[model samples]
Target: MSLGTRPAANAAERADNGAMVLPGRSHLRAQRAVKIGSLAFLILALSAATLLLGRYTVTIPDFFHIVAGADIPGASFIVMENRIPRVLIGILVGGAFGAAGAVFQTMLRNPLASPDIIGISYGASASAVFAIAFLGASGLALSGFAMAGALAVALAIYVISRRGSVAGYRLILVGIGFSAVLQAVVSFLLTRTDINVATDALAWLNGSLNSSNWDRVTVLSMALAVLAPAVVVLSRPLRGLELGDDAAAGLGVNVERSRLALIVTGVLLAAVATAAAGPVAFIAFLSGPIARRLLGGYRPLGTAALVGMVIVLAGDFAGANLIPGVSLPVGVITGVLGAPFLLWLLATANRSGQGG
Candidate 1:
């Protein structure tokens, strides 16, 4: 028999001998299942910790009772009114950032290409800051401004990066440069604003959950509810696009249209997140890479979202309780967490001669 026929006969013999699982495919499937299961468990555990551990901490029994519509003294309001909204918002914003970050990184084919890093977050922040400082806008109005700002910035990057078509490397470079400009605008606005306005703006810029409420939560939820599914629907096209525009086009994907759709969707996700939580630091930039590492480079949006949830919820809890007599913002904690990782990645990339 030929070599391929011999291998096929051996496999057939192995199967006849009661080896039910195919070695390579089954092993990969099992590994993925285990990874996904572990991620789900971690997210659930972290969520429980988020709900149970706080200043007005709720016991297991009372927490269940509160969920069951029981009127417990002091517990009901704290759980339902404050903690619930906070936790829910954390999940939504984190998921949105995570998914958006993954999409951006995948679309651009660069690990460093993320919303916060490439100027999308700054666009949202700058616009919202402008509204807060000058237009005296708050809440939903600020969210609108953020959305508009992000879209504008994304479009500008696309336009600038295009010679005949959008090039991933050029897009990233332009985005980084534009990000600097947006940051400067934010800084300039801060300096020119009144002290009180600037104080609120600074808190927003730092990305706090201090003002998380049902209204903001609902708004973000609706936005994600629309945008996330769209991202998923476009995921196949996105995967195709990753193989290069020419390959994607050959695969029956409209490369330009798909790219544009992805950019809009990603920007919208980032915008809503910034609107809700003031662009909580590094959740976007960190989630995709973390998930990629955990899942062996196959980017799953759900996994990325869960990673983001854990990061934000856990980070928020640590920021609130870990420090003595001081509560830092969630963004501060994430910034701290991500900075070291970024440096390490940079060093590693440099060592490998991958950083151009």
Candidate 2:
């Protein structure tokens, strides 16, 4: 009605549109800092606990020296020879799976689109099992099989996901179907193999750290050292993806290209992890949500990965020592712990009329 009212309206509109640097940024940074600190401390703590909590325990000072390259009769050997490699492998592989799972879920816009459910881990498991049983392979050769198998599984999932068009629901449904087929192949291969070979395959399938040596650590460390940096570089595009496909593309996000790149990155990360740790179970599926809850926030791939490393190492160690009679496989332990959460998710989905 009046010129003064027009100016006030315009000013109000501008204020709403303006970037005033919300307090959330500082909070996010604080969360980032906290997560980073937690990761570092957790790594140290897990390493120390792994070394010191064994049958032949060591004191704090002796454990420190043992890690710092001093010689103690049994302490040095255990720390250097046994604990360090295992801890390192757990951290690297766990982090990769967590990060990969986070990125994949964000891209697919579905919390259930993780590698474990979508046949990626099954792919690697099938391939690695075959290699171990048939070729009598161990060590680094198994790593190659795992990586190839995981990537192949990823490719198959992608093709199926893209069968008609790129619908999130369709991709997830197809992925479930693919996982069934992969599991059957894995089962058949184990049945046909020799007993000893089957034993080896079974050990790998269970995802134990009992056999984790320096060689496996070396393979995973190298993969993670490279892949982590790539993830950081792609963070911008990945963040854009959380806004949904249409919005992301409208922001010049190169939707298809970004999705493809992220999927490739995620598949490689999971494959490398599988190669190193044999699909240690639930880390990929559970890490992101757990990390989100821990931070009291949402998905941040790097933070999620760090949280993943902590969860896996902690779970693995706990499983080994927490119960005396059963030194369970890390995979079995995690699966047991994560089953309730998975059930909760299923119940929530059904209540919402969302198909599994």
Model 2, span 33-117: residue lDDT tens: 7877978798778877887786677888997887677899977877777877888888888889899989888778777989988
- Determine the C-alpha RMSD for candidate 1 after optimal superposition of all C-alphas: 2.7
TM-score of each: 0.93, 0.90
Clashing pairs in 1: none
Segments in model 1 whose C-alpha atoms lie over 4 Å from true places: 1-21
User: CA RMSD for every model?
Assistant: 2.7, 2.9
Best by TM-score: 1
Question: For model 2, what is the error of residue 105's alpha carbon versus the real structure, in angstroms, after optimal superposition?
Answer: 0.5
